[model samples]
Target: MTTPARLSAPAVATPVPWPDDSVSVLRNRPVRLGTDPASLSRFGDDDWNIRPAHRDAHTTICNLNLRVFPEPLRRQFRAVLLAALDHPQPVEPGGRQRSAEYIGIGSMPVLARGLQLFAHWMHLQGVRQIADITDHDLDVYLQHITGTTTPLRQQANTLNSVRTLWLFRDVLPASCRLAAQFPWPGRTANELVGLRTSNGENKRPRIQDDTMEALLAWSLHMVEEIGPDIRDAWQEYTLLCRGEHSSQAIYVGTAGPRLRAYVDQCRRTCTPLPGIPGPDGPRINYGHVLRLIGLDGKGAFSPAQKRWLAGQGLPVAEHSTVGVITGQIQGRPWRDTPLAIGELSGLWRRLAGALFTVVCYLSGMRPGEVLSLRRGCCDTDEATGQLVMHGHRGKGYDRAPDTPDAAEPTRPWVVVGVVHEAIALLESLHDQPHLFPAQLRVGMFRPSATHARTCSSVNRDIADFAAWVNQTFRRADGSAPIPDDPAGNLNASRFRRTLARFIVRRPRGLIAAALQYGHVDTKVTLNYAGAPDTEWLQDVAVEKLELVLEQISDDAQRLAAGEHVSGPSADEYRRRVVGSADFPGRTVISPRSAERLLGSTDPQVHHGEGMTCVWRPETAACRAARLAQGLPEPAGPDERECRSTCTNLAFTDRDITRRKQDLHDLKATASDPLAPRPLRDRAAAQAERIASLVHRHEQHRNEGAPA
Candidate 1:
């Protein structure tokens, strides 16, 4: 069998040309600092598109890189730096002015700020190479980039390391080639703008009690001057405050960077966080900025983190409290009176302006979640008419782990009866649809399915609102302590803590009633679905029905209970109703494994549980077996035989045992292709894939390469 000679190959079909230097540089496609080929390939061609809204996968990627970075920095670098690198380009640098979707000024600011910071780093490294660079040029350039004034430290607080590193990567890639006659000749290290930890007072934006007081006083006067209603003007003003207006604030950076600065300033009083040093540079250490996550040395308060500490009795957090009690209300703390905020221009315009404070104190809903409420999400239950808070996420979103997703991701959230009253009161007055609604006009119609709200925004709205409320309302009793303005001011997050305190300190007789605090306690635990309340009985019943098919074993108990017990369809139970009438619901009971096997083998097993066993006298298998075994077979013509007396073969314990074991073996085999053995071949395949990835990563590492 000689095969015809294969056609001669034409001189190795012209070898493909390698990428040219210019094209290579252009197509460099900067890799995420720790991107691995295996991961890249796993994503196939969508390497840059795998932007998970949450940080888990990215955290995993960064955690893998933790070996390179220190524990303190691993998370921040990954969260900020790696994220910036992950997305190489912006969809739009500033924002789409004509976007009908109204993508908010808030939504784009952080990105702008992040990009600017990254650019700053690159600019620092390339400053020497750029033509005619001087301090004046640098100041103008930096203000242009960061949106701060001549003294970078004086204007406002900035995200230090994260901003710097991001600026470093992003700015250089685009502008390095466009330096026009000037060349960025410095080494890679010099090109990166580094941060030094400054203990200086100006570097940190101080949101002191006095500042808050002044702002409140300023707000009140502005509101009074507006006279009655400035609904149209107020709406625009709020939009401007959110940096949504075409008219931008006078700041060092662009309109976006200015908003970012606002966020930074606001966060100082909302979600106070410890400052991390810039990548490869000294950290801007402001002892004044308090940290929510405490410091190691004496656990000194990070002046930055003081906002959350407002109600926490922290000395540093007292500043905000003083302003809350004095400036906004001018009413004594002991009086159960609310000073009108109507006079204050923008004060009444904010959704969280006042009502949220009372709600947080009484009901215990998280300020952020409460603020984020929409009109229709709150409903009075049809059965009990209890106020139910519904959303993907809002307040009271704590568990023990500090997740970036906390209170940010919208998920199913419930507000208890306490929140109900306040919500009702607010609804009766205001008609905004979005809860914790933003002043930015462009972002309210819909939500981004891709990302969650930022922690800073969530915190800021809450803190500012809390301050207004505390100042607006006064306690009747002189014993009630006034909020300290310098340190403590109302913040959205303080609601959770205040809630916990309330539950613990509830009046002696009202302990049980405290469960009404959103019903998260025993009502909505993992062990149960929904609340124990009767309203959820139907849902629970259906869930239990599924579990019975998966986990239950008692057949007589199941049958006598009168459930259909053996059927292919769940809809059968829907036809004839039986469970608890108090709880009208659906039940799902499917054919048992043994019944399925028996039915398949001998089609006569068509009976639901609790039904009388059918005797197929025409061709009884037991009678036939008895006849075959030398016992007298029933003479059906004359009609009587003792063969029917054998109860052992008719639904006996031994038979059931044998049948159950058979079903177990059958199910076990079906569950695993490699049956009779515990571990399946599929597990081995998964192990091999993971091992391959590890090996590939190791190969790169052995050669001193980046991940």
Candidate 2:
């Protein structure tokens, strides 16, 4: 923190050599430089090799012109500005060879602006050279930059940028360079002191379980209805495009006699077939009818035939061509036909949109990963009958192998049953490289696979589907329709968080617990077991565990402040967390730390299936665990152990609500006349236990209520 001498206007000024065209770049623009414009004519040089043609660079130079300083000082400032304008070094080694230097790039404007601010501050303090700055001056400059509301990280970035000004030492005069010293040591933004803040992790919104269920239910139904229709339409179009006209016209067996009857009727009455629209009017040409059955060469329909066809509600045409159906044409090439094409295309879009929702939500894959999925990515596990999907990591491509032509790394996803069904439906729609092919608005066939729909499109499809369901569907009783989310936001990324929350709350030994999450690598793991693209699941799990601990601590404090808590383990929980000297305030305990400390001391906290356990090992009341071990430490409650009689069990608000629900259901069971006597008595006892706990908790809360 050495102080340098104050500076004043220098005795002699040196001429600055700059390009003649530099004035043309800034003369018309109203760029602010925070200093006098006359000061700029002193020091720019033509020797500066950086681009004067680029917009950002040009503007920066123009703004730099306004910072009026002595010639020597301006030279050091210009050198620092040029250095900071250089392109960033490539981060990945594999792409380094392909990288090119960018012109008019980098944060030149930001650098210029910071320099201008620093110059103004320096001007106010009468500091003209780098050597004149002191540690106290640097401290005051930082204080001025970082306002009361400025985020610590942003403040750190600004300070880090200012640190680069020290590089001007190389360009300074010998006397100035010798006296110049940076107040703070150069360090990374993260490593710098005062940048650290206790701001909590960002929490994204997750779709509620009930809302997710409703969405899936609607999507599943839509898939069932339209999936088969789309598949059939595509199949027929394929057959027709290949010119299988005769086979497409009729079905064999019992329909042969019926077909003959229809043809014979058409021949006898000289009428047109039903469901076909004609040129101008709703009637058929007899000559055209005869030509369809190989009678007339001209293929003309008579007035009698037109009248008969019109009576049957079929449109008549003057001549026979490709579109005119003379028989049952279920398998006909109908892609070229307008009506069939429209119906099929609409169905296909709906099917793709619905399938996208099911796949992304159930698999919990990111939208980018889902979009990257190819046609054959989904497959069945032969032995276990589980659905597995393969997709590559989209965001962390830098983790890929550094080879000349390295393939993008892939991962597998263990998907649920409904997702597998959706994949199957998508596959049935068409045979294409991409699962969701790019389709033209009017065509039945896919256009190309080169450009797949992006995540923005995926999000649009989700919102559109939600809107469609809300508008089109109704409850069976017609009492209440499925409501949209109050927030009116349904994003594709939210599905990952929704699924993670769903998995974490599932019961022990469920599919979630059995599954492993985190990045999967190696051929065997990718082919058989899925590796998650990220460790977000683990992070979320840790966050949830910490949340549970925090909730317990809050409850303990409430109990200490004369608030009531009426679980079997409430008293013990209070003693451990609230009464303990180390347990104070809102503290976050790491998952690893909690795992190490759990059940280690007296009145220990134990995580179980239904409730938390806080009990003395010797006096543990969990009958199943106690009987098996006959000791408190080893006799932790089993998943199936009695929650009612266990003295170590504690309840939070959600748990209390669950308890009330249990009480209600048990009362309903006990009041049933059909229930056996033993069953009724058991139900009554369980209900009474829950009721007592609820009553005690309510009474405590009422006693502690502010009056």
Candidate 3:
């Protein structure tokens, strides 16, 4: 292949007015700017903590460190970043201005990182001024980034920063403006980087069935059973921290009598002193002993009391303070050892992760939306008694360039009762306004910091939870409770896709499905899934289409295996299935391709509990009912209104077998002397109808056989 021509700079344009270095890029979020913007020297300062007030505490403060770049490139880098900060929706040369809202303050760190990479590349090339960088240099930088192990998404973002420089050229100072146009004209950064455009397919892998089940089950266990114990322990720990009962005089005057009485009661009741696991074996938990007697300090036991306890076969250790652990799993203690004060923080995090898993998987809310939830966000509708959550929709909001407080509008999500339990657990875990706080306790960072948890931290929480479960909990056979999924570590984003899969597949005996769908009616689930803000309804549609295709392929296999198919649409079903012999099972197909195939075949097939619907919409019996209800004509069969005598009914051998079993059960009920006369009559009539249907099915099957 011939070498492409080197890119050269285009004509320089007149510079626009540059904002003072002291002006903040963030529009209205002043409190979180950390330092006075007027005092900030963009060139002199190496670090600028410009984290937006609205951002989560887990999000690192945005620091545009100019020190990392070569000295010669710092000014240009600052210019590009400031332009990005000031004019986020800058127009491209000879292109229409973007109509989308300006980039928020939260995006500055990402934009800075991308620009930093570009500046570094320019530095290495010994190109100081933006005007001197040629098209070849841009091409080489692109090649370098693409060749790295960095993900395609990040690479696209990095290249887009370079394009941003060109887009914002008019806003930059003359010395910092790029003379050359962006080398790849009429091509998007994603296209240039070879990243495929999204075809409406959710690329996130679904958590495996077994792994999801165990994870959710353990999560529920944590929220319902263990959470209360943790809360009680936290309260006790907090009280101990207050130093109200730590006076030596108080212990000598009142605690001595309480301690003696407690010991005597334990001896009389034959109750063993609370113990914690030790190197030798179980040892006395002195912390519990102190708390039981209303004593505050450890080592408050007098020498005489210690001797008395030793005589009673209970000995206090020097530094043992195992707090109470009352939670149980599978009728056994959930923890073998008492929870230590030091370990409470970690356990709280694990508990938070468990609650996070339950909420994300059950509510089908985005992780950010869930993280944004505050105390009292969830409530029961007094009239309907339906549990609903009201929280900010984190995505797709329009903000004016000058509006600093453009808050996200509150949107409602229909959720199950278990979600209410999870929310309650979260509320008790911390005092932060947001349900999922960035920190469960005051740590080495700011003691007063109060922001929502970050998505990355939530992902880590999920992975750690799975690991913790495997190490801490066990099944009846002593195997790990949470099995490893082939799809790798669970994250917040995958749960929605998993939920969609569950709703579509309706797997037998799946607890998640039962918890998610069974407690609520179809309308509630649909309200949650079909909300215009969510992609879940589309996800369901995609899953349903994939399921239909799989069913068609399976039906084709059964037909080839000599299974008889009998119904009003039997021949049509066979023709469609056989014609779709080219259907690729489980192979990745683009959405457009799936749509085209679906349109071409027009099978309109939907599998139900005991029959398959090969629906012809024009002649469908359900169409009349839909029209009567003032609903639009359905694109597929309405399984709820499925009729036995409808011409759309297609029966396979499996359906026939199920029908025969039903007929036998009906006959048994009809002959029962104990059954009410009305019930017997109805059962007998149903049995006769089913028997007639079976006879006709068999007769048709035999007649269609070799003759």
Candidate 4:
């Protein structure tokens, strides 16, 4: 194609006065999910209902509850399905009823609800079927899963609606031909929800207030009669009963076990769920005990361990001179364990430190993003100003590297100021050699689940300090709390999550934050900052790209671990830090959207902006209907495999000459130091991206489009 010549400009048109509201909103609003209408034929692109034309929207709602609580739902769902194999609905009715058995109200109501939902969803799909069931029937089905509209629950209107819709989407199969076989987790949740419907009352035994008071008083009397350490455990158990923030008591792991044993004894004497009697008087399962200790398994609850805590009770607290708390109580709220500096700083530090957490939290930068930071990325003018941690090692320059392509990875950790203090502290603590150089420490340890080499040690130090603070400064009640450990909760990965959380809550300072990330929408920024990937998956093809942030951080170590050819050396991390690229166009693009729009790079065909193709005039199809003109098939799929397919069309000498000349000109022009920075930058970007794609194809074997 000849380059179009630029000629004369048109005269300026008269300017019109602008409207008061100059910001015209774009047509990019996200599709919100709900269960107002279900499709019979297939879901359509209706905002409130399922969309038939858009598979993304259809699948968006499908298997979601699956993602929420996968295993339990699957187990419960499968059982219902097997039992209802014979139940049938009109298979041909508006293409509804993947099957009627899914709706059976037998022992399982949730599964029935899911079936009803699937049918409704089918109706929403576009097959306007004559009613098999009336709207009253649908309401009956809705009541099955979420407990009947108690006023307390009614207030959660959105949640109730979602709960209702979750059931509807439950029947859509993960990859089923017959919709009945769909693998939605809603099947399982519905089953668990099944428990309440069948019983019509709280089945599990709960300790009443008077009884709890007696138990606490007894425990305190026993502890005061016994030892100091046991007394502390008794006190903690009492606090649990009172619902105090005695989560602090978990620092002593033994406390949970002690209190659990005490509670278990009391449980044996109470009334149990109907039919399932207490072991002696009342038997508690492992689920209940774990809850006391703050450990939640997926959907199922038990006291933990195989059997209940036997008939025995915990001995009265006995005083120990050492005053040490250990075991169960010391190890509670394990989820909070190894408190991520990112989390601690974010929650406790006025949400300011969260800004730092966001940066390192997304980018996974080295400590330098926070500690060794400079103001370059965010501020062009302020050279030595506050650093934004916007570090991305762009693609290879000049000739492309021959190594395997590494896919475009998103930032998992990007931090800002958690280390600002640490940096200043390090300046006081150690002589400058890449200050607070946690990377230097990473080389010493083998990768252990107990401790992440880079991120953990820093956090460990911070936790120590935090713990120390709490211990040093006792409460008015003379209790020692955390932040007293002397090892502060500040560290290497502190930069990312703190910054991300900060950005999420306070996006107003984004331009300032953008000095680190640049101004992207807060939603995308949250994902970059490592928010869970619940939303944005079933979006338009254009927005899918943002998924990279989740992928990268979700398994930074796993990704890095699998990638490491040998033990991850220090330099390897540094490379990831510098070589990473903050995905561009994040405000409008999401991970799923990006993947659909940009197919993976393959050298087999020209891709990206440099693609070229030629149409063949001799093809019969091309010549067809010249007023019923003869036509030929467009060659065949074999030519698409990359052959001389273009030969079907006559090639003029000038075309060949120009192509050869153009290739030469492109090669020379590609080397210009004086070329427009963007073109040169784009070219470099393209080459790097090509390498990333190739590497991805090698690693994953199934690299889809860019998203």
Candidate 5:
């Protein structure tokens, strides 16, 4: 059970010159290093600010701090990381060059973090230099990371970080390079760590229907009702602060009379002096009073004046109670108490969060894309009157010389009117170029150093907003406005998935219908998948194919239970379902295989309003209409053109039950004496045909039953 001694690395004939000082691997050039001179020194500094000079305002600056690594291994680790940045590794063994680009600056921090973890492990194993590490040591390290509680994806990343040592061995200085090839060669990090590769499925959990409904409802209430008041209060507070900081000469000239009139008016109207919460009791808010009177300094009010104001018999309260509360909840005032000056900032944050929810959920924009939106990004199309959001795609870009920034090409998202309202509110909330800035305000309009709110920050905002809604508002039955989602906290990414699910489930729903006929031309494709700019189309296609397979499986189960199916295509339905009964539910299927399974002839079941369509193009009644419209032959029945006597119709027991209900409704209408004569005759004819269908279904069911 003895551990083997580490072996020395092989010597190199021509050693690469390791620089004692050089520009950081992150920066392409040190053009605007700002006040930090250490940014230019590669080996001298531990903290490297990896923020690119041309970075988008929405993207947060990244830092790679080597301070966490042990001092002895720092140089060696730095060499490996710099080599990774300087060189391009093959996409695969002997594969074509990957976009002929170096690793992106954004990915450097994550890579550095993984390397730092490996350095610590190496230190623990008494292997100081990468060259001293042996294959056996790497094998043990792999096992160590695998055994940890870290997720499989992270473990794979850590392993890939170690592989970099060997990947760039030729470029590294002889002493810093791994002599032996990385262990587990020919196997990917995913395979080694047992991380399953994605099968184009969107595993992001959709927010439950009730939860989404409640969340959207409360968000709409905040935007439509409470938002204006919050905005007005913020504007007033900002102006008061601005006026307080005005020049002394101007304030002195206007202060004397204004102060006298303000005190006199407060006393006359019996209005309370604005104050903040105090330990002893409510005390006069001197700052607020000074700002209100247009005074410049804290000592603007004298002792005699303060005493005179205190003895005026005016009430003191945390906030001005004189303003009208316009927002309501459950037919009562939304707030029984006035909004405190201190609470204004929290209200502003909540308001922004609500806006974010509305825009993100309604537009199906990624969190980053939403954050990248600028003040004037949204506009109404003049031709169609459709709201279109013009923003850059934050993903799916090749890290090339021409486009080095985070944003991709400008893309348009067809949004609803409410999305435009949210964007307008955001534009008014902050003066920053980004619609969702990191800082809303700090007494005055000032953009944050980071400029934009990160996705992680927006996530917190949304979660806090939900909690705030539940705490502040209640339903008629006394329940939280937004129920807790079992999928955990609702995030930006989940919104897209939830939206896709809803679009698929209810294509005729308000949002879906609007998107369908909007300028975006998002019909079955986008409704079943995702927006044009997103990768959701493929994910949705996979989901749809899986759904079809699931339906076939369900049909098999029903048939196994001896359920009767009748119609022209009933035998066809049984044959297809029985043939595909062995189809696996969650197993990985290639795109080609999925396409074939979803082909017109395979598992030919299409559920319609009152029947199951086992489509055969020649027998389909909807085929002629599609051809007349110059459209391609349909893969399934067009439910809009479905005919009662269509030969491809297959009626299950469920459809029969629906038909029975339809027949009852028709009979009632046909026998109505108050109905017009022609309408009654039409209803009577339809009822007779429906009755015949129902009778035939019952006869078929009885004949199929075991005797």
Candidate 6:
């Protein structure tokens, strides 16, 4: 094929030409640009109408120096690279904005490197032309990527890059295009890599329950101290900035008397202070002014502030410059209380971060979604009375500005009361609508790419908060300080997965409960919690049921072998349920057949830790839940509330084994010479009850079994 004319004009024009200085510079390398044969022949001879987004891709290609390859190879390589760039990947589209989806700018370098690697490999194999490359050649490249000692993740990346470039098989020379018998299967990168458990879903650590409780206690206390009054102060501060007034409080030191006279003179003449600070860069040291007014720290003060402060055990130093009179000297042990801030400005900034931590942990929103939230984003739903958070989705957003999508990518998330309070607190801190603004500059705590922090900043703040809690908090009785989590691995992303685990582990934590957390189905929750699928949880429940059955089977087998049995119900259970025709198998049961394995009349299996409830709801001994509430469903026995005397309770093999040991100990106690008559009688009675309970379980299991 012959080389065609220059590629057609793109959608947007650029003054710079392709193959500028970069192509010229590459000529000094081992390879030189081949004589122009046909770079665009494999692609159609039509003009290229590059979209505005593709301008970057075009620039990457130009810089890559496509001319370095031999004429035919160069032509094939140019067609594939251009094609990959031409079709941008579309973001998942929803909302008002039509997002322009394209391949990432970073991937251009990877694609270029991949092509170079393939070319080098082909050269080593002594294959001169693109036509000669075949399935076997691709296999060699795959093997190269998955070298004997290469890390699994690295190998996966290399294989993916090769696969990405190879996708333009249709555009390649007829001989060079991949065939039906291609070496690598067109499966996902994970499948192709064949690495077990590479997803790292289980790697994130959950915050310990006790540690979470402690952190929450500290956070709530901090919120209570600064939340309401600081919000009002910030609002007034913002108003003052916008109004026509020099808001800088006069800094009067030795010149206080002179300044007061000058201020009075200037006020009469209606003159302004020289170089009054603008709102953006206010010259006023508000921190110093706050100190003067006796409002520097978090606590409230009386109207007769000086007298009140002195009377309240705060002794003023005679020569102290700061206006507020406090016994709190600068050098002292850090007391375990609300932080004493000398400057009030820093208090609100840190408070915003603390509020952010509580909101993210409680709401279960992704870090990006929470960070993207603006002021007034929190609203009560009129229909449901639920508090909802509105923010742009960070993922799946289009880069194009001109696309006819909605101006605002607002999404609503249902949040709890704490999150609502946090948002309200944030709104009071700044006039700007950013819910989590930071001090980028003096008097400018507004949202900007530089100032408005992301997840990294949030994580840092969370870590700092954890450290602060450990340092400042002590037990109410003042015994020992709260210990830090040993791992100290807390982060924002892990909170969702941790919450999912907690719900799954709870009693009656079914799909209905899972629905309230993330707006996802049972299957999604299962996957998030690292379970195989929806059936995985059910399978675990069924396995516990089988374990109890197996224990019963083992006991029956021992009794049949003429082994000694001491429990009151041990012999009864062995003869009735374990030896009955209704006895279940000890083998492993898959989730699919679990339902059919146990019928309603069969041994009722409610597996709890170290215990099982062979409950018959109709005859349930503990009816507190169902009886008083008039609930439609039967009130099953609570495992924790289960009494030894309850008829519905069933002991597992391990429990039965322990019961025998307990009976022997009680019998020994009854026979002891040191025992009183009343103690002996009580011991003897307890022994009989243990044996009777064991026998009762066997009879119950037998009754439930198929007759």
User: Candidate 3, TM-score vs. the true structure?
Assistant: 0.77
- Quantify all predictions' global Cα lDDT against the true fold: 0.34, 0.52, 0.69, 0.31, 0.69, 0.48
Every model's TM-score: 0.28, 0.50, 0.77, 0.19, 0.75, 0.49
Cα lDDT tens digits for candidate 2, 495-591:
7766655554544312122122221123223442344433444444543454445546665666556554457666666667665435443333443
TM-score of 6: 0.49
lDDT per residue (tens digit) for residues 371-430 in model 5: 867779887768767668887655642422122233344667778788888888777776
Compared with the true structure, what per-residue lDDT tens digits does model 1 show for residues 19-137?
22222111212222223334332211212222222221111111122223333322333333333333333322223223222212122333434434434443455542222333344
Q: For each predicted model, how many residue pairs clash, with residues at least 3 apart or on different chains?
A: 84, 13, 4, 159, 0, 13
Model 6 Cα lDDT, one tens digit per residue, 1-707: 45222222112222212222222221211111111222222233222212222111112122355655554455565555564564543222122224444454335556665676676676677776655766667667777766647667656666665665545454344544434233365354556667664322234566676666566655555565545544554444444333322343443333334334444554576643322135553232333233343234423333454243223332222121211221121333223232222223544554655787677766656565576566688787798787777665444424221122324335566667877877777766665434664443345222141134556666676666666555554566863343456656667776654555454434332222222323333323432222223432443334334444554565457545644432223334444554443553544335445535543323333434333455556555455544556743433345534555555554555656677788889999889889999999999998898877566555655665411
Q: What are the root-mean-square deviations of the candidates from the true structure over C-alphas?
A: 29.0, 15.3, 6.0, 30.3, 6.3, 15.0
Candidate 5's TM-score? 0.75
Best candidate per TM-score, number?
3
Q: Roughly what TM-score does model 4 have, to 2 decimal places? A: 0.19
**Candidate 1 vs candidate 5, lDDT winner:** 5
Kindly report which residue stretches of model 4 are placed more than 4 angstroms away from their true locations once superposed: 1-380, 383-421, 438-453, 475-502, 506-707
| Residue 362 lDDT (model 3) | 90
Residue 208, candidate 3: alpha-carbon lDDT: 87
Off by over 4 Å in 1: 1-352, 361-363, 382-385, 394-418, 435-487, 509-519, 524-707
